[model samples]
Target: MLILWTQGDTNGIGSEVILKSFHRWRHRPHRAVVVGSYCMMKFYEKRLNLTTPLVEIESLNDIPMQEKTPDEPLYVLSLSCNIKANVGEIQADAGELSMKAVERAATLCLSGEADAMVTAPIHKEAIAKAGYPFQGHTDFLEHLSQSGRAQMLLCDIETNLKVALATVHIPLGKVSETLRASGLRPHLTALANALTKNFGIQTPRLAVLGLNPHASDNGVIGKEETEFLQPELALLKQDFCVDGLFAADGFFGAKRYKEFDAVLALYHDQGLIPFKMLAFETGVNMTTGLPIVRTSPDHGTAFDIAGKGIANEASFLSATHLAIQVAERRRHLETTA
Candidate 1:
């Protein structure tokens, strides 16, 4: 598969991690091309003192129509940014460049020019400063792909733990109202389909966490669980092998996530806190329910460690592997169908 990897914030660790990950993937079978500023990548290449040769390409067509060999240099479809790298500061130009790369990569995937996409981390604040109104990559991708609703799925291959968020990039106070407004059915359906189609699970068992404390402490803490979750879960169970209303604290505290194929959390931190605790170094964030496959490292652009040359690329590598695996599975399903 030909993967289009985006260069995220130029001032952050995106370039560092991408270069590091490429250095480690020299023997991998899949072909990948970077879509960002050639100068930025070159800067990181020199800073890191790595000899992974970079071959600049004017467009995706410039890539040779063959699997990249171990001896081959990394191909880069360089975009023009014309900004110097500022190691640890957020710059509007950096944000613009990052989003531009994402736009190009997503367009390629939608056009079938690229099999899948592995995005490096983009700084949210910088993007906002750049005048784009996207909450994050998920919503931006949803708009770009025109996918009805995109879901965030976090996975740890080592522990086989997967968590999908019902509401993302929203305030804690608004999660309840948002859930009430949109309901949980769509998210559940998306999660189920993603597990079956992308992860190759046959008859996946799904679990959902409660909205309130102790699932509303049996209606003592809050009414969201009693009034909203229970009824929705009952209907969802008819269509899915799903169980829910589990207390987030004890459910994960007692390691209940392992019993199911995937767990669905009501909000972001509820799912991410535990998942990050378990697999921070190797977590992969996947954007599901999109027309094209997309995944990124679970962590963000670590500004403090941007130019230190100590940034770990484990999560990015895992994201790359998962993107390739999901893309291949999708290809198989398409051919067989």
Candidate 2:
């Protein structure tokens, strides 16, 4: 598979991790082409004291149609942008370059010119200043492809853990008022299909977390579980193997997630805190329910260690491998159909 990779914010450690990662995976099984500014990559490669051979190409068609050998070099589909960024300073030009790379790479995936895409960590505040009002890659890719639905799936394979958020990018105070059965039913349904298709589970077991404290503690603390969550779970039970209404706190504390294929949380932090805690450097953030495959490192752009050459590339490399597996599985599924 030919993977289209986009470097994220230059101010952060996105480029550093991307360079450090593929260099480590010198014997990569598949071909990948980086789709960001060439100058930025040159700077990071030099700063990180790396000598990964990269060939600059004008387009994906420019790559020779042949399997890359173990000793072969990687390709870089460098966007013709001369963006220069300070190591730890947010630069608008860096934001724009990353945004442009993302848009172009996603378009290639949508056009069937590329098999999949693995994006680097992007700085939300910097990208917003670049004039794209996206919350993150999930939102931008969903909009870019005009996808009907998008779900964020955070997975840690070593831990055998997966969590899908029902709501994302909203304030803590607005979570309760924003959730609804109408919206949640489809999200959960889509997530179930993802677990089955992507994870290859014949019967995917799922758990849904309650929104309130102690899952509302029989109405002592709250009733969203009684009035809202329970009803939705009942409706979802007909189509899913969901055993839900678990309190968020105790569920993770007791490690109940081990029994389920995936956990559906009502909001972001309710799911991510435990995920990050267990797989801080290894989690893979995947966007499900799109026609094309997309994945990213679970962590964000660490500005503190942007240019210190101390960034870990485990998550980024994991994301790339996952994208290849998903794309290949999807192709086989389609061909056999």
Task: Choose the strongest candidate by TM-score.
Answer: 1
How would you encode candidate 2's per-residue C-alpha lDDT over 203-293 as one tens digit per residue? 8899999888888887788778777778778987988898878998899999999999899998999999989998988899999988899
Candidate 1 residue runs with Cα over 4 Å from true position: none
Runs in model 2 with CA error above 4 Å? 181-183
List the candidates' TM-scores in order.
0.98, 0.96
**Candidate 1 RMSD computed on C-alpha atoms after optimal superposition onto the true structure:** 1.1
Q: Residue 166 CA error for candidate 1 (Å)?
A: 0.6
User: Model 2 misses residue 208 by how many Å?
Assistant: 0.4
> Alpha carbon lDDT of residue 64, candidate 2?
80
For model 1, what is the error of residue 192's alpha carbon versus the real structure, in angstroms, after optimal superposition?
0.6
Q: In each prediction, how many residue pairs overlap at the backbone (N, C-alpha, C within less than 3 A)?
A: 0, 0
